[model samples]
Target: MTWKVLLPVGEATEVMDTLYPIFRLPEDGFEVVVAGPEPRLYHGVMHEIPPNENIPWDITREQPAYHVRATEAFRDIRPEEYAGLFLSGGRAPEYLRYDQDLLDITRHFFEAGKPVASVCHGVEIAAAAGCIQGRTMTTVAKCALDVTQFGGIYVDQPVVTDGNLVSARTWHDNTPFLKEFVRLLKASVAPK
Candidate 1:
């Protein structure tokens, strides 16, 4: 049977963070189902530091990029149908965390011990859902507080895996993050 994974996203979602998994999961025989607060196309953005000969930006800059469509809405999601969850990062999580339905969906993954992957600000969603308490994880430095404030141990590493939860500091760490997450997903479905 093909396994389906849930990917939660919203406007301003980082392009690389959102698209990589959308395409990569299929290579492992997993279907990626994009979900959002509502069913529609969300505006994605690219984030990078501006290199200047005279002045350098202190943080990543955001620019409009692509539009990704959510195949399902958070309110309609049946979390049990998904074999895992991927929480991509961007400015989106700054607000996506406010949606009760999204938080509920996020909680189901951790509560059931399902495989979960999170990158960058994506940790905000899990933090808000109160799923990270006592879990050691990593995220973009700026979001480290989100992990600590929620009672999680914030590791400043490219990737950190705590049981079923695998996390990366940013999209740059996607390779390792997805690697570990896929392993967990496969193990979950392997017949004893």
Candidate 2:
């Protein structure tokens, strides 16, 4: 059977974070299903620290015009039908973490012992969904506290794999994270 992976997208979704896996997964034979608060196009953003800029912007203030549309809604997802779940990063997670529907979908993956991968701000979703307790994971430094606050051990590394969950600090780490994540995913679907 073909593998299907759920990618929960949202407004202000980091462009790199959202797109890399979308393209990579399909190349590996996993169906990429884009989901969101609602089934429609959502804005994506490019996040960078302008070299000359010296001020930090609260995510809400750094909005750029990038966006990605979701082909489906979190409320409409059947988590059991997918092999894994991917939570992308950026300002989106700052708000999306509060979404009950998204939380439900997140719980589905963890509760089922499925392969789950998250990067950067994606840790917020796991924290909010209460899935991080006692789990070891990693994310962009700024989000380190979120994981620990939720009772999960936060590691600083390019990539870290704990049981069925795999994570990276940012898109720069995508290469290794995807390498490890795909391996874990394939193992999950391997013939028993």
Candidate 3:
């Protein structure tokens, strides 16, 4: 049987963070359904520290990237119907945390112990959902407070796995975190 994964996205969602799993999960037979505040096309952005030393910046630079189409709306999502959740990162989370519907959906995955993958600013959603408490995870250093502020432990690493939740600091750490997430998802469905 094919398992479905819910991915919440919004305007300015990071393209790299969102694309990797969307394409990779299908290789493992997981169908990814992008969920938005409303069902529609959302703009994505590229977040990175420019390679040129001419511009010294402390944080990532965001450039408009490809668009992501969210076929499902958060209000229309039934968390119980999906086997896992994948939270992508970007500036969107800075605002999306206020979404009540998305928060409710995020809480269900953690409460149910379903596999979840969060990267970069994605931590904001999980944090706002009240699901980060007591769990250790990683996200962009700037977002460490999202974990700690919500009563969770913050760690800096390529990947951090706490129970069914797997997280990474950024898309740069995607390989390790996604590997762990895929493993968790597969294990969750393994015959008991």
Candidate 4:
């Protein structure tokens, strides 16, 4: 059987964080479905602290990059149809946290014990969904509160796996992040 996964995105979704899974998941035969606040094209952005010889910026610099289409709107999603949930990080989650539909979909993955992965600001969505409580995970240092505030334990590391959920600090950790996510997806399925 084909394994389907859901990726939630919004405007300004981090290109690296969002695109990595879009391509990587298919290589392992997991069909990736992108969902957003609406079924439309959303812009992606590059986020990084540009190298500076003098004073360094405290936050990442954002510049527009590519576009990713959301074929499905969050309100239309059927969480049980997916085998996994991947939340890509970006400034999007700052507002997406208020999306009731997205929050509900997020909760389903955790409630069902389906494999879930999150990176950077992606944790905000999960935290808002009330699914992070008591779980150990990692995310960009700035987002550490998203975990602790939601009664989850936060760790500073490349990746953290607690039960069916896997998380990473940022896209830079995608190597180990996606590797572990793929393993979890494959293992969740029974042999034919």
Candidate 5:
């Protein structure tokens, strides 16, 4: 059977955080379905602290990057049809968390015990959905508050795996994050 993974995204999504999985998932034989607030093209952004400058920047600087097309809207997502969920990092989650449909979809993945992976600000969406309560995870240091505020345990590490959920601090942690997430996905479909 072909397994499908749901990837929710929006404008300003971190390019590496969003695009790496888009291309990597297929290599493991999972069909990636990109969803957004609307079924349209959304702009992606790159976030990084510039090296050696007159004055150091405290946080990542966002710059417009690539364009990714969302084939489905958040309201149209059928969580039951997906084998897992992947939430990408970016400023987009700051607002995407406000969407009721997206929140509901996020809850479904947790409720069903499906494999779930989140990175950076992506934790905001899961936090908003109330799925992270009592769970331990990691995200961009700046977003650690989002987890603690929502009743989840925040860890300052590259990656954290709790049950079916796998989380990472940022795009830089994608290597370990995706490794564990893919392991969870493959295990979920293993013959009982």
Candidate 6:
């Protein structure tokens, strides 16, 4: 049977962070299902440091918008229906971490010991949901404290996998992170 994956959607979701898995997961035969606070189009953002000093340092990166729609809502999702879950990066997690429904969905994967992957600011959701305890992960350096504060070992690596959880610091690390995640998903789907 083909596996299903839950991808949480939100405003300002980092474009590369969200899109890489959206396309890659399906290549491995897992259906990527987007979910959000509501089942509708969510805006995506691009992040990159400016090479020109003409731009303000505080606004080092340029932000461009893209639209992504969610197929379902967290409150209505059945976590067991999916074989894996992927949490994406962006400023979205700063607010999404507070969402009770999202938190519940985040918890289900960890509690079930299912395949889970998170990148960049996505660590905030896992930390907020109390799923990072005793696990090791890597996120954008700024969020290193968030993971440690939540009792997770914060490593500064391109990819880190502990048990069924896999993480990457940023889009630059997506290649390795996605490779490991696909391996885990395939291993799970392999005949036991």
What is the TM-score of each predicted model, taking all chains together? 0.98, 0.93, 0.98, 0.97, 0.98, 0.95
Model 2 agreement with the true structure over 74-178: per-residue lDDT tens digits: 888899999999988988999999999999989999999999999999999988999989998999888899998889999999999888889899888989999
Scored by lDDT, model 4 comes in at 0.94
For candidate 6, report its TM-score.
0.95
**Candidate order by TM-score, highest to lowest?**
5, 3, 1, 4, 6, 2
For each candidate in the order shown, give its overall lDDT on alpha carbons. Answer: 0.93, 0.89, 0.93, 0.94, 0.95, 0.90
lDDT of 3 by residue, 38-116 (tens): 9999999999898876869889888999999999999999999999999999999988889999999999999999999
> Which candidate, 3 or 6, would have the higher lDDT against the true structure?
3
**Alpha carbon lDDT at 179, candidate 6:** 98
Sequence-dependent TM-score of model 5: 0.98
**Which tens-of-lDDT digit does each residue in 26-89 have in candidate 1?**
9999999999988999999999887773778878999999999998989999999999999999
For candidate 6, lDDT tens digit of each residue in 18-121?
A: 99999999998999999999999888988876666775565327487788889898899999898888999988888999999999988999998889999999
**The CA-based lDDT of model 6 is what?**
0.90
TM-score quality measure for candidate 1: 0.98
Residue-wise lDDT of candidate 4 within 6-37, one digit each (tens)? Answer: 99889999999999999999999999999999
Query: In model 5, which regions exceed 4 Å deviation?
Result: none
Residue 61 miss distance in model 2 (angstroms): 8.6
RMSD per candidate (Å) reads: 0.9, 2.1, 0.8, 1.1, 0.7, 1.5
TM-score computed on alpha carbons, candidate 2:
0.93
Model 6, position 69: C-alpha lDDT score? 86
What is the alpha-carbon lDDT for the whole of candidate 2? 0.89
Residue pairs in steric clash, candidate 6? none
Candidate 1: which stretches are off by over 4 Å? none
The top-ranked prediction according to lDDT is: 5
Model 4 root mean square deviation, Cα atoms: 1.1
> Cα deviation of 94 in candidate 2 (Å)?
1.1
